[model samples]
Target: MITAIVLIQTVADRLTEAAQEVADIDGVAEVYSCAGDVDLIAILRVTNHEDIADIVPGRINKVAGVLDTDTHIAFRSYSSQDTEATFSLGLE
Candidate 1:
């Protein structure tokens, strides 16, 4: 599995809508509106590396309010619990 955090910059007054659209995209696990340099944060998971290429520019970056995005792909995922539990519940 591949996981990534997509830092999204959106047009003014579009965070809520952009977050919703991001969550609706395939391979996106979660989307949150944030108060920071980036307007939104999104969690994405895919079966392969190629999926990121296909999903990001083709789907996410194409969303109406999305201005730009920076993606941080996770190289390692460490957890005490099962993988599913860790990912699903976001535990340490």
Candidate 2:
């Protein structure tokens, strides 16, 4: 799977609505409203790179009140869950 992290900026008054709309889009896996340079963070998981173009500009950007989006394709993923699972293998 290809994962993309989208940093979204929305109209001040429509932040929540915009996030819901983006989350409803097909490829979006999760959406988080956060404090930082961007208003919302959307995680997208898809089968290929082309899907990023289709989901981001084609769907996400078109949601009402979405002002702008900055998307980054993930080259690798590292997490404590993965590490824990790796270390626990064969322990059962």
Candidate 3:
């Protein structure tokens, strides 16, 4: 699976609606309203790399109130859940 973290810039007054629309887009796994340079973050996952474009600019960017976006494709996932599971392997 190809995973991308899309930082979204939404119109100030339309954040809530923008996020909801983003969440409804296909290939979008999750959307977060956050505090930072960007207003929202969207987690996009798909089977093909090219699909990222289809999902991002093709769909996501067209949503109402979405002003701009920056996409970062994940090379690896090192979540705490995965780390904890790894450390617990031989402790049983």
Q: Using TM-score as the measure, which candidate wins? A: 2
Tens-place lDDT digits, model 2, residues 4-83: 99999999999999999999999999999999899999999999899999999999999989989999999988989878
Model 1: per-residue Cα lDDT at residue 82: 59
Q: Of the pair 1 and 2, which is ahead by lDDT?
A: 2
User: Candidate 1, which segments miss by more than 4 Å at Cα?
Assistant: 79-92
lDDT by residue (tens digit), candidate 3, 1-92: 99999999999999999999999998999999999799999999999999998999999899999999999999998999979887886755
Error of 3 at 84 (Å): 3.9
Alpha-carbon deviation at 91 in model 2, angstroms: 6.6
For each candidate, the alpha-carbon lDDT, in order, equals 0.89, 0.94, 0.94
Candidate 3 matches the true fold with a TM-score of 0.88
Error of 1 at 8 (Å): 0.3
Total clashing pairs for each candidate: 0, 0, 0
Score every model by TM-score.
0.82, 0.91, 0.88
